[model samples]
Target chain A: MTEVLSGLPAALGVESLLAMLAGTLAGIAVGAIPGLTATLAMALLLPFTYTMDPLQSLGMMAGIYNGAMYGGAIPAILARIPGTPSAVATVFDGFPLAQSGRAKFALHVALVSSAAGSFLSAVALMLLAPPLVEFALQFGPAEYFWVAVFGLTSVSLLLAGAPAKGLASALIGIAIGLVGMDMITGAERLVFGVRHVAGGIDLAVLLTGLFAVPPALAMLSATGKHAEGLGMTGPGIKVRQALGFARTWLRSGLIGVTVGVMPGAGGNFAGILGYSEEKRAARDDSMFGKGDPRGVAASECANNADNASSLIPTLALGVPGNSVAALMMGAMLIQGLNPGPALFSQHGDVVYGFMWQMLFTALLMLTLGFAGAKVFVHMLRIPSALLAPMILVVCLLGTYASTNSLGDIWLMLAFGGLAFMLSRAGYPIAPIVLGAILGPMAESSFRQALLISQGDPLRFVSSPISVVLVIAIVTVATLPLGRILWRRLRARDARRAEHPPPLRKDR
Target chain B: MSTPPYHGAQVGAGERLLVHAAVAALGGAVLWDSFSQQGASAYFPTAIGCGLILLSAVSALKVVPRRLLTSEATLVKGLGGLALLAVFALLAGEAGFLSTALLFIPAMALLGGDRNVPRVALATVSFVALAYVVFHVVFAQSFPPEFILGGR
Candidate 1:
């Protein structure tokens, strides 16, 4: 505690403070735009940090990390577009709430939830890094495969009303995810002679197409119709009302931090898991996908919560949990600070100072994001016709800027068209995104586990963690079925009560 | 899972069955392709193919048709919007982002039923300027070479 406290002065240094504020501002801008990922922004900013003092550089990174995670919720709420992959779950409830004229309320929920999650996650990292790192290390190849499967199944099965459509959407995504070079064999599996596709579909392209384009198309289709209420005005939800969601914040924060500590599982998975759990826990989940504030809180809180906890592994064991953490590790190496336990012994102050930066930057984000929400809610005031075209422009420009590949833009358009058709068929598209994101992880881990076990199928259950994960996957996959059976039984009882089952005649 | 049909649309069971059947066929084709493959990489796809087929069959049995949410007019508009996007993408490659965006915005706005030409033109200019400032000026992103304006 004393050693950690010693870092506060450096964290509060003028340079560090300025860097944090600037980085946070830049991060918010980067994250609010489609296709400009926090990962890309941080990567671009990494070089500029090399010559700065370690605390200052680290503080900037901390600010960007927290800021981007929260900023992602903005576009997701006002439009149906997710500014970042982690914000996808936020769209489930955020967009609906906005359409109901509760844009301000939804934004407030997201802001508070994000801040609370990030703050608690930073605290968890400070106090629980060692144990979390150890726990993360327990996930073997089999466990990782099951974890991916668990995330995919839980979200797909519960996100929509029809389990069949949900699962099928995910299956479609997996198939699309398979349309590239196979990592294990180094051979093109489903490229079908397309050279551009041999590199595999970019996640950004798919995300932009699936999330942003469909909405734009919908707005165009509804152009001449009675102007759909964009919910530019509504009753204000008090900050205290947002605070009343403490239970959801804590639950989702725990899920986020847990997933964050696991290597390769980032905020996207955490957000999905948090949303699924929130929906599952709700007694009346009919409003879940339609715009429940709890859903936004769950998703935003979980994703932001992971921001700091994701560093636990990188700090304790030198294994970066995600790309941003890997970049942060690179920053430390550039500063001649080696990672791992010995680094703590050598530079306890800088290490703890960075954690402090994470906590303080999250607080800064809360203020900025709360104020920014007031401005962002005006996005709904634009006519849907003009707004639709503008959204398409942003999506187009963003996708094009990411890789400078026109082929990606074409692919995005194709996905958008197909997505619009599937959505018309009543298939929820969120699972497709979830599936694509998790598919590669699942496949790679599945192969690795098989290789390690020498092709023994039973090896999936060889470890306790894998066994638990397998059980979780089964339970999650069967949850919809269980719900259906329960509903049928209840209906049957109701029918019997209504007519006395004609058995009363026999009686 | 017990929520009402999506969008409150009434779906015909036969239509749903047809959709499921189509999905099943697609899954079957994938399974067949995976079988022809000659490596460990095929295993995952093969498993997915089977799961998709099985799920489609199960879904086929419980078809509840919802409303025809997308009218013919809406479908036409949706297709038109896609065509507009495609044209914009292709044109940008040749005319550069700035020139193409200038044309694309007004065209898309018109297609979206914006009949006010001056307002559309104003929106077009403002949006293009904002895009230039954000993407080109701030991020320093490179756009394709233009026959008109010099490329960034």
Candidate 2:
């Protein structure tokens, strides 16, 4: 802690402060746009970082990561469109609340919860990195495989009303992840001979196609059909409501940190777990799907929490938790700063700077997100007719700028169409994103674990941690069914008490 | 899963079977290809494909068809918007971002339903200029290629 405190002055230098603030604002704006995502923002920032000093670049990236997570909730609340993939679950209730004109309250909840979640996780990173990384090091291929599986298990049951669709969506995501080069043998599996795809399906390209395109098309289709994007009622902020949400945000943040510290499970899992768990816990299920402010709290908080916590494994074990973290790793490498135990010892100042910067950046997200909320709330007043086209342009330009390829633009359009069709058919979209993100991690780990044990399946169960993880997967996978059964039994008992069972018809 | 019959197939019991069957076939293709890959690399894809197939089989039981896949207006609207985007993409490389954006924004607003040419023009011009100033002028970081502009 003292080390981090000592490093604060260097981190607060003009260059670092400017870079972080600019990155955060840029990230928020980019992320709030319909087609832009946190991944795309970071990917775009990667090249720009080439010119900056290491600490400044890393601080900028941290700001972007933190800011982007919160930025996504803006569109999700106001437009029913999620700005980032992690915000997908936010759409469940956010749009509904926005529809009913509670956009102000929802935004306040999201912004506050996001800040709390991010701050707590940043603190967790500061206090727990050394110990957590030590624990993370004990994880072999088998443990990593199960960890990813545990995340998937919790998320696959997210849409309990549509498990089959959820599973199908997850599988589709996994198949997409299988594209490009194989991790183990360097063989291509599903690229189908296209150079673009063989290079691998970029997550940002997919996100834009899957999230932005459909929404743009939807807005265009709805033009003049009905009044949408009406201005939100400025109910003004409430201190009591915020205090009431402290417990929920704390719980969600902890979940995020726990899941995020595990490699391969990123913010999306955090969002899914946070939302679904909150949904189940809510006494009024009807209010949940229809835009409960609590739902916004659950999602925004967890995803932001994941922002800081996801870096834990990356900084500690030299393993990127997700693609965004991978980009950070790229930045570290560019600076010739190797991530490992030696990083702390060899470059204490930079390490502490990065850690302390995360805390400072989270505070910035709160300040900027709060200050900017009213200004951004006005976006809802713009006519969708004009807004839709502009958003599409932004999406197209953003996606194009990331790769500078017409090929990616075309792919974005195609995937957008397919996503539109699937969405029309009631297929869950989050699973596809999750599968793509986690599929390879799970597979590679599973395979490598097997190889290490020389093809013995028993090795997974041999380790105490792996056994615990397997048990956790079973527990999570069965939780929905258990809840359903418990509910049914209670209902039956209530019905019996209300009236005796009907006499047999035959009698 | 209790999917409400959408647009209106209006019954429970197998409304989604067709969709599931379609997904199963897609999953099968994934599985078949994975089988052809090498050992370690093939492991995860194969498992995922199998899981997909199995889950799809279960999904086939819970079909509740609701709304028509996509409304005619939506289809036309989405397609029209996509067409405009395609034009922007093709022209982006030759006309340069600023030029393409200037033209594309107004056209898109028009297609999207703005009749006020002055408003459209203002929005388009300001947006294009602001974006250019921010992306190209300020940071000097992000620049997409343009053929006619000699970017390549």
**Model 1 / residue A413 / CA error / Å:** 1.1
* Sequence-dependent TM-score of model 2: 0.72
lDDT (Cα, tens digit) per residue for candidate 2, span A1-507: 676676788788889898889888877776676545666566555544545798899889888888888888877777676667788888788778777877777877888888888888889888887676567768888987887677565555664356667667777878887899876678888776688898688766776676567666665554432223435565845898798988788778888888777654678789889888887877777888788888889898898888878787667756555657656766786688867666876887887788878888888988898788766554334555676777777777667666778788898887776676566556756556656766776787887888889999999899899999899888877777898899999999999999997888885
Location of the lowest summed lDDT over 10 successive residues in candidate 2 chain A:
A221-230
- Distance from true position, residue A381, model 2, in Å? 2.2
Candidate 1: residue A339 Cα off by (Å): 17
Tens-digit per-residue lDDT, A1-507, candidate 1: 776788789899899899888878767765665444576566445544445789988888888888888777877887676767799999899988988888778877888899999998999988886554456567777876876677667656765568888889888888887887788777776676789988888766776677667766666644432222244347656867976899999999999999887654679889999999999998999999898899999999999999999888678755454556756775686688866666777898899889899999988887777666555444333455666777777777767776678998899898888777667666777667657656776788888988998999999898888888788778877878799899999999999888784444554
Over 4 Å off in model 1, which ranges?
A1-118, A121-130, A222-362, A369-374, A502-507, B1-22, B65-73
| Candidate No. with top TM-score | 2
User: Candidate 2: lDDT of A125?
Assistant: 87
TM, chain A, every candidate = 0.61, 0.68
lDDT of 1 at B147: 49
Clashing pairs in 2: A173-A436, B5-B66, B6-B65, B6-B66, B6-B67, B7-B66, B7-B67, B8-B66, B15-B63, B16-B63
DockQ of each: 0.33, 0.33
Q: Provide a comma-separated list of chain B TM-scores, one per candidate.
A: 0.71, 0.65
